[model samples]
Target: MDVFPDFDGMRGIGNLQSVAGALLMFALIIAVLMLIVCAIVWAIAAGTGNYQIATKSRNGVLVALGAAVLAGAGVTWLNWLIDLGSRL
Candidate 1:
């Protein structure tokens, strides 16, 4: 009994590595854009003495940082899982 599912001839799942790479690239780009926007908002809010807006923008920055970290780690984690599965 094979533990790993046969991926051969699976036309629908075309080029998984390329797909994953593209998705990760997109995620990183989005995260960076979010970070830039958040930084601008925070700066503007602070300059205007709007503490509420500043705080919210700070939170947005954190969320964007978290997303970037997760996206970067996700690929490594997925590779590790695949290696572990193959060893089973």
Candidate 2:
């Protein structure tokens, strides 16, 4: 009696890989766009001597960068964690 049933038959699932790839591409594009926008805002605020706006824009840039980094690493990290858990 196997506690974890064999899932070998489900290896050839639907087009999930393609879908995940597309979504990741979309997220990267959006993150890049947001970064550009934040840069523009920061530049404008700096030129206008609006320290508050510049600060906010700087924060936005950091957040966008963090999001991009997380998005890129998320899948690999998740897979690693799952593998570790299975070994436990």
Candidate 3:
């Protein structure tokens, strides 16, 4: 361990926050790409006249996205419920 630490020349919150914001942007980019790919595959499969096949494929994509959204909401709801119960 060095005796004296260098706190000098430290770039503060702005630099760290920018890096975190960039990571969030990357996550959004990945989500958008996934949505686009899912839509495209669904479209191609849908071109086939097999109604069941297309419906299942579309449903699969919707279910995946819905699960993500619902999972997020569920966590928030569970938190709220915990808070509500604790007050009772």
Candidate 4:
């Protein structure tokens, strides 16, 4: 019988789409909170409160957000991989 070469690719594409959609939703929520925090940080920096503090906080937020997204994607991918393997 004729057959598909890469079942994993199909699963991967689905994972990409699913993760991206979830990320967009997450981004909307993150945007609201980050908007306020970022503004506060910038204001503090502009007001000469602590330049390094503002920079460090900004970097921290980025790392936190990135970690969250990466965790989400990793979980999604692993779940999909397990499900796919089960079907085989």
Which tens-of-lDDT digit does each residue in 5-85 have in candidate 1?
665545533356567868987998899899999999999999999999999999999999999999888877766765575
- Using Cα atoms with residue i matched to residue i, what is each candidate's TM-score against the true structure? 0.74, 0.70, 0.45, 0.47
Off by over 4 Å in 3: 1-11, 49-88
Instruction: Please list all clashing residue pairs in model 1, or write none if there are none.
Output: none
Q: Could you tell me how far off, in angstroms, the CA of residue 20 lies in candidate 2 after the best superposition?
A: 1.3
Clashes of each: 0, 0, 0, 0
Q: How many backbone clashes does candidate 2 have?
A: 0
Give all candidates' CA lDDT scores.
0.83, 0.76, 0.60, 0.66
Q: Considering lDDT, which of the candidate structures 1 and 4 is the better prediction for this target?
A: 1
Q: Put the candidates in lDDT order, highest first.
A: 1, 2, 4, 3
Best TM-score goes to which candidate? 1
Q: Write the per-residue lDDT of candidate 4 for residues 1-88, one digit (tens) a residue.
A: 8975565555465666667667755765665566568657867885887878878767756765675566556667766776686576
Lowest summed lDDT window (length 10), candidate 1: 6-15
Against the true structure, candidate 4 reaches a TM-score of 0.47
Q: 1-88 in candidate 3: lDDT tens per residue? A: 6685454544454554455556555654555556566677778877866667667667767765665565455545655655564455
| Candidate 2 local distance difference test against the native | 0.76
